[model samples]
Target: MGQKKRFLLRLDEKLYETVEKWSADELRSVNAQIEYLLTEAVKKAGRWKQEQGQSEKE
Candidate 1:
């Protein structure tokens, strides 16, 4: 098991709708889309971390 962090985000109606559509198209829940976006952002910003469980065995 892992710890969880919670955060609140605010978005305009139009942006929200876009994300809703994207989530549906990708078969992901709204929460999942947000998490995916955050993960990408962190990686792009060079602040993301790869968990040991997620690493490929060498």
Candidate 2:
């Protein structure tokens, strides 16, 4: 875990509703689900680097 940056995100109603449902299904808060999805997307695209000595324990 690392320091989290906070900011505002403006999303369309339909998208927000969909994400809210998905988050509930995954047993995570909407914010957590969004972070999880973004992290996965970055990893999938090979655009994020693993911290030194960090393990892929996810």
Candidate 3:
């Protein structure tokens, strides 16, 4: 693993609640859940660098 960058994120109350529930169901923290979703989206869009593994983006 690499050092993670941190920043502030603000979400609508309803959206946050939905993500909270989904995160629980998936047994991941809210932050991890969001990261997972974004990673999948990037892969689907052909933006993830498969040769470099999941942590790299292109």
Candidate 4:
């Protein structure tokens, strides 16, 4: 693991509410849910590099 970059993200109200609900259902914070979604998209696009000793499932 490494230090995570931080930035402000502005989302549409409806979209935020949707993500909030989804995050609760998944037992993850909104931030975690967003990161997870982004990671999955990247992997699906073959744009994510797997770190040493890290499985794709991670």
Best by TM-score: 2
lDDT of 1 by residue, 1-58 (tens): 2777888989999999999999999999988998888878878899966667785221
Tens digit of lDDT per residue, candidate 4, span 20-56?
A: 9999999999999999999889989999998999987
The lDDT of each candidate is 0.83, 0.93, 0.87, 0.95
TM-score of candidate 3 on Cα atoms, chains taken together: 0.80
Model 3 pairs in collision: none
| Model 3 Cα lDDT, one tens digit per residue, 1-58 | 5689899999999999999999999999999999899989988999976655554543
CA shift of 6, model 1, Å: 2.0
Tens digits of per-residue lDDT, candidate 2, 1-58, equal 8788999999999999999999999999999999999999999999988889989774
**3 or 4, greater by TM-score:** 4
CA-RMSD of model 1 = 3.1
Better of 2 and 4 by lDDT: 4
The TM-score ranking, best first, is: 2, 4, 3, 1
User: Per lDDT, what order, best first?
Assistant: 4, 2, 3, 1
Which residue ranges in model 4 land beyond 4 Å of their true spot? none
Measured against the true structure, the TM-scores of the candidates, in listed sequence, are 0.76, 0.93, 0.80, 0.89
The pairs that clash in candidate 1 are none
